[model samples]
Target: MQVIKKLKDFRTLELLQKANELTLKNHSNEITLERAIFLSWWCEKGDCAFCYMSTQKPRISDPKKARRQINSILAEAELCRRMGWNIEFLSGGYGSFSTSEIKSISQDIFKITKQPVWLNIGITNDLEEYGEEISGITGAIEIANPELHDKICPSKSLEDITNMLEVAGDLGFKKAITIILGLGETPDDLEYLFNLINDLKIHRVTFYSLNPHKDTIFETQPQPASLYYAGVVAATRIMFPELEIVCGTWIDNLANIGPLIMSGANGLTKFPLFKMFGTRYGKRVEEEVYWSGRKLKGTFTDFNSLKNGADLGELNPFIKRYIDKCLNKKPLKE
Candidate 1:
């Protein structure tokens, strides 16, 4: 096992290359792409320093609007199913609703979609209350270090996050966690974070690069280097060989995708399938405005094409060497 003591060590391409080899050895060639829907941007606690939604207006008592939003989400889920993506994920801004509300929404969405669903509806103290209603739970512990987590996300405690994960695991739900890179956390901090995940037996992890929103507190902070982000992905693969490493393609640009996949990510998440299909959800102003200042646009193949054995049109050449080497298969020329 590779032991990295410094953050800079993760920036080394050679280390990333070695980690990529290890990832191929453990997991096969196929990359998994999962679909997700943003249920709501309303957070009740509203104290996370790094999130743009943290300072948004509180959730108003408007049942009509809420119902419309639910209908729109279901419509989007139906489109995703037609597109050949069956695993649907439902997520929202943290503390947006009560645990009971989340359960109700999950049950409704599951019933309407009739598909496997993963819930990322923020921290719920009683996750086991849902029982088999949810296929999995994503407990996002953005930063692992207690001090950093406290400083960055004051709304929730690390203890609470761990408790949620433990409860989800005990309930036999497929457990996953999301970790944001470049949140002022160190290599030791990451080591500590993964240790906790291993202890909790959480096997699936998603990594997001910190893309600061304009009005958020973290906006003034320097953006994380792309290479540094890729390094962290590679390092995570090296540290947890058996764990599934997922890259958040929504947060990073197209150029970084190759390096991220080559480094060790076996799955992609948070893709904008609805946006690609030209579905307008009416909340676009609020949603697009937050990610506006940053250059979030990029060119990538749709999930359906990749699922049907079609090569990534423009991206295949750049990543083919790594994919070929990892899969031990012949290379294809563009």
Candidate 2:
């Protein structure tokens, strides 16, 4: 508790550095990757003021098209698994589909990707209905400000979400949640947010800046300033040293990617994977991460020439040698 207060008092650089250090000591230099599958855009309560999904396009209106879409999605999932990407989580408007429909598609995804599926099914007692197929559950109170939550997300309930998390705990499922900052929430609200996380013993959190979408209630609400967002991220890391913290960002915000990495985000969520491998935005993200001296596989970075000055050559060899030394064996044969 004292440590959290001290973190609050830290200046920008100090706070970021402390968070980075804790991450390095507790986690690692490697940034894990995560991706979300949008099952459908048909949110029944499409009035989420801060969201644009409802206003964009329609998915649930055409059952045939939606069913065809799932086949393509399954192909993509298989390819991602082969390309070293983990289909970690699934998200969408569940209000339009029956639980059984979700279960069928979820099982299909798991059968191909061979990874645990973490889903946001929300406020239901039916997690076991999916059996071991859905191994994790998320109850997102994206807006935690009591004053604003009902106004922004009228269909969502804080008490119901609390109940959902408790049930997830009892089922021994991996539990996670998300929080969007800069919704006019106050300092007191932030304190309450962390306390709720502690009380729930959440296994992971995904943090996002309030991204005002077109034609929504907050269409004009400016995105949270990059530095302010980074500070909140750092505070989350400092508060929960070993907790899995995933940050959400878009191509437009790539400039702050380095600061976010240095501030203790262990993974990225909602990133566009389709554009990541061959596009300019993907290259920009790679350089930003490389400049931070963090390693990401498949980027083929040359650590030797990078200004961050973390050596690249022979690092893999050294890892082998370190293991050999532990076994008191001869030098690495390679």
lDDT by residue (1-334, candidate 2, tens digit) is 5444544564657778989999999987887556777776666667667877557445456543433356545555554554455565777774645788878888887876667688875567677677677777888788758768888877788888888888888888878888898788744466777888899998888888877887877889888878777877787788889988888887688887788888888776566665444445666777787898887643312212112222334333433332232334222221
Q: What is each predicted model's overall lDDT from 0 to 1? A: 0.64, 0.70
Q: Candidate 1 local accuracy as lDDT? A: 0.64
After TM-score superposition, what is the CA distance of residue 110 in candidate 1 from its true location, in Å?
3.9
Question: Candidate 2 lDDT (Cα, whole model)?
Answer: 0.70
TM-score of each: 0.75, 0.82
Model 2, residue 146: displacement in angstroms? 2.0
Could you tell me which 10 consecutive residues in candidate 1 have the lowest summed lDDT? 292-301
By lDDT, the best candidate is 2
lDDT per residue for candidate 1 within 1-334, as digits (tens), equals: 3545534555458767777788878987655555667767666666777887665655455423433255455544544444445453677775555678767777765765575578887777677578556888888788867888888888777788778878887788878888887778876676787687788888788888777776777888776777877877877777788888877754336456667777787766665543433222212321332232212121122323223333434433533432232234222222
